[model samples]
Target: MAQASAPSGLRFHSQIDYAGTMKISSHAVARMLGAWQAGPGPAHQRLSDRLRLLVLDGRLPLGAALPSERDLATALGTSRTTVGAAYRTLVEHGYLATRARARATVRLPHATPSERPAGTESATINLSFAAPPAPVEILHAAYAAALEQLPRYFERHGYDRYGTAELREAVADWYRRRGLPTAPDHIMITSGAQHALGLLARTLLSPRDKVLIDHPTYPHAIRTFAEARARLLPVAVGTCGWDTAQLQAAGRAAQLAYLIPDFHNPTGMCMSASVRRRLRLACPTIIDETMTDLALDGARPEPCAVHMPTAVSVGSVSKSIWGGLRTGWIRATPSLLERVEQARPATDLGTPVVEQLATAVLLNGRQTERPDALQHLRSHRDALTEALAEYLPDVHAPRPAGGVTLWGMFPEPVSSRLAAIAPDYGVTIAAGPRFGVGGAFERHIRLPYTLPSSQLTEAIRRLAQARLALTQGATGTHTPAPVA
Candidate 1:
């Protein structure tokens, strides 16, 4: 077969023979000459600089086999030792890779923004959402019972804008079980936790009202507050947890403080009871207990709404059972519930009648323990943590007592870069800035341990590879480069 010609605009022969049975191309020689002439330095430094430039400039495409050290030396008018040193430097910097059978091949140090790995289809391993699977036996029975009671709701207009009495009672009972003093009249059901937050934001916040949140908090909560025109005050949350003193100070300065007291999103840090008490008194609190039921280790030490009667507690079955349920409730004073209800119609008519019935059924029944589901989640979390510890020991990560994610901190300020590289590893990880109030947490990454154990292992492996690429000194993906 005739050798392949180089792409247009270059002047070079198709092929030239080197050693016996080995062929070198003029295009490759031209790349070497261009690199050598472009620099002014010592022999080895100039050669290394040239090779790095060629790799970065796409003159040598990623995964393309490079000419042998001896051949490159002959073509570039340099010693073989100098060529070998150049290749070694590029390899060390992640610009090239070599193996026994294959020659040194050009490789971009960072993943391209558009490149994505296979096996991450919609139906495949989805680690993006951190919620767990529903308890099958309990959920199915609830649906069956709700279907039977469907006739009862058919008679009414079926739209209780505030919430149905029966469902509110169930929500109150759930809080009561946790030792909090809750009243049924204080409860208002909503489509989900996000809806509840939206209602609160619309009802309470004016333009640029200061709202306090942890540094690495829920992304949705930040967006909701921003849309409500609130100026966000973000206090950093360390590996140990939030700095309560700083939080209280920020709370005092702000109109509202949004918090996740149990199994915090992304970080999974349950608030200490002392911090909860202090925060409640310092600010009008909106507590999101979305991951309350996902405590794989044990119960949370403090009730999210325990200290402040003025605080609004947002509860949802989305994390406990299934997101498809779309049923969540707010526990607050009746007066507050009335205000939220006034703002509710602007967003939704009400929570769906059938889904409310289903959630009520589930809450009312003697729910069975979900050992299998718990075990599956626990296994995934452990695997991911172990992989991080083994492969990227320099990164800091806390194994949460509960929740579905492992929040990791990188050695460098490269979380955004890693997020861009993750898809190449067949994973989609949320960068730390996504959770922060004002684009903080730039050195962090959140990995959801919600997929199967096998998938989690593969995802972590890919993350390790991506991290290496980002930190090993290759020109980053975000940098300007020539397009092919």
Candidate 2:
């Protein structure tokens, strides 16, 4: 790592060279500190806990360098001594390593607060996901607010499978706000986006039917359609973005199409306006906008459903708000929704009313990604790209404008092998084949920028190590998912 002059009036230095050794810009650190913007108790203790959680959650990969105390303090808008205290606390707990005139690096402490202090222990970092941490304060507020409205639902059977009326209206409003006029009658709330897909697949798909999907698509969706006994039809989505003509052509022979036009997961690729307009599919379509609200740059694009009013749109707060919300909706014709409602009872009676109430509050709140969150995701994305550039220069990773994950392409079919060996290097990765069918996508893997920038850097460094270890005949043993 190389040092650079401190920000004027600041005493600590910044690490400028980031290619070989892991380093994250101060800007990104602030974003990852979401709810910790102001601690409920002492600043240092809260900061220490937050950093520890990042490491435990695999958001901060071990071995990544931490920004200088002064640099982090400036970014947090706090005093330098406050950051110094936090770093010292981490060092004491075995979460960080520091020496004279050197940057602090991350490590998993042998003992956590729950465990008695003892010898340092090693752990494997889970990289199989990219979900965001909940905005604790905001979520608590919503739930507290939900309590007030809970009494009104006491009169209903609470087994209404179409979802609570309040949430349905709220979801419709969400679509309208997105520039697509929607009716509550056309919306049916489900457990989550996956649940929404499962229900739709059950209602709309017949055995042996063909379902069109992006070549490299959401892994869960592939499983969902397959479970319903549908054959998969894939249209390639590549670096140049979607090929509208190819999709429309694939649509003709398909029973239905599932697409992620905005903030496409795994790829983080967005379709062009002309392409969106030119697309005309022959079958009913299911368009997923679960990642719509995560745009880091450019205005929120119009939903692909806008171009085809008959398209069934699926969305959730998983990305924009929190994945644990367990609330999602499907937007389509009232008659179609009516049929879905009839089939849904076979799976479950209905969604939970309290969960619906909280999501109603979230959806109707007209909330956008917090300024801190967008900045945080952008910073993490840049950090991930930079890390790959340094450690795996041969791999190609495109910088995305929005969403949490990045799709990385390697020169060979090494993704499965990488996943198998990553645990040995103290990291775990979702292989390319996990995202595709028939052993396809062997040259690709998805990298999410949802982790802290420092963790993103560290995780990449661990990945580089895993690659080398594999070459040296390293074997792996899986470990537990960290919880703090």
Candidate 3:
């Protein structure tokens, strides 16, 4: 029998009614920290810090069982003593609790032992977003390079609505390398990709203008278009990919279209070159390449504009490098960008000079976390798949070639119910309807492999518990948004 493990070491049930014990795979842990080279601290301290950061960031997640020291040392290519010391350090700091034969479990360092609520436990794990934490070394290096370039801009007032010259040029160079030749004038930087989308929506859409989008698309894109008062013409993308004929069929009627052709968000499916070539949409389409750098497969697809030149591309470092960077760009003709620049200030003045500078360093230097992140992503993906197989065998989750999420299909409309009861089991999963318009895809759920293998395993276990509870007649399937 298994028992639900709480972050604060709270045990409510004497015997586990369902979900078995979880043991994290060593490969999964290694994948979570991709290209994590030796940092400034001692070996054990560095390992401890890295693990601690993962825990604090909700990546390792509380109550997940860790692999044995010997197993982890072998996986990390380090000595057992070093791994043992790291575990001891984590234990001392309250990040982990270990027994003799049992694997160590993650926990938080609390000033006081908090009391559990009368009927439920506090929510711990977050599986809503699919993106991973940034590589610490690469981020620091980029910022350091940005600081070296910051003095030149300090003399100016720094209100660069069209974007700084360095960032614009870097964005153009990125496109050129991706097989879409772009000039500096064609690139306009914004706070991030979402900001770029908002700017485009504001500039391009009139009230009730029909805009084509994927039915189960990025939630924020739907919100952006809704705020712009555009009538969305959504084309559904499935396990295979987007229906190109259907997309073109819809695009012909719309004023504008939004697409994520390369490594799509929730599905992780890459659009075929054939689809790209045949996407002869009459309207101006926007291709989001935020996840282009997160290709788990060896092949990286080219920009959509390469096949459909009329299509514009929007990109950012959020999916690839770090979400906090808030640096992204729009690739379009100078004339269109002029219109976008004019409407930019309604939202904000401009992208921060420092962030733009840092992004430039990463882009121009051709620095990416993909090579390091790919193996890790693949491992985590496999881990998630294995856990799902073990915990909820009925749910079918496809393994995508790239991108962050696994679109799982449940036999019943349990997505919303699962989300509602997940907190009681100490996990939070995004309901399928969150990604769809009109609360569709109730039987589907987007599972992110961003968390560590151990966390993924435990989260799946919790999900299974919630599903079982639903059958046992839990509360109404109305999950409130997490109070962040």
Candidate 3 deviant stretches above 4 angstroms: 1-123, 476-484
Provide the lDDT at 297 for model 2. 84
lDDT tens digits, residues 1-484, model 2? 1111111111111233645556655655664454564535788887876666555433345777888999899988989998999899889978899878878988866742332112212464556777888889888988988899999878877788788889999988877888888888888989988899999999999987888888678888887886686777777787788887677767887888999888887888877888888777999999998888888888788888888888898988888888898889889898998999899988987888888999998777755457787888888888999999999999998877688889999986666667655665666778775565544565787888888887777788888877776667653323223210
lDDT of 3 by residue, 138-171 (tens): 8899999989989999889999898999999998
Point out the worst 10-residue segment of candidate 2 by lDDT.
2-11
Q: List the residue pairs that clash in candidate 2.
A: 60-455, 61-455
Tally clashing residue pairs in candidate 3. Answer: 0
* TM-scores for every candidate against the unseen true structure: 0.72, 0.74, 0.74
- Give lDDT: candidate 2, residue 291: 88
Looking at model 3, report the run of 10 residues with the lowest lDDT sum. Answer: 4-13
Ranking by lDDT: 3, 2, 1
lDDT of 1 by residue, 292-371 (tens): 76778875455756667678889788876788888888888888889988888888889888788888877776241255
* Backbone clashes, each candidate: 0, 2, 0
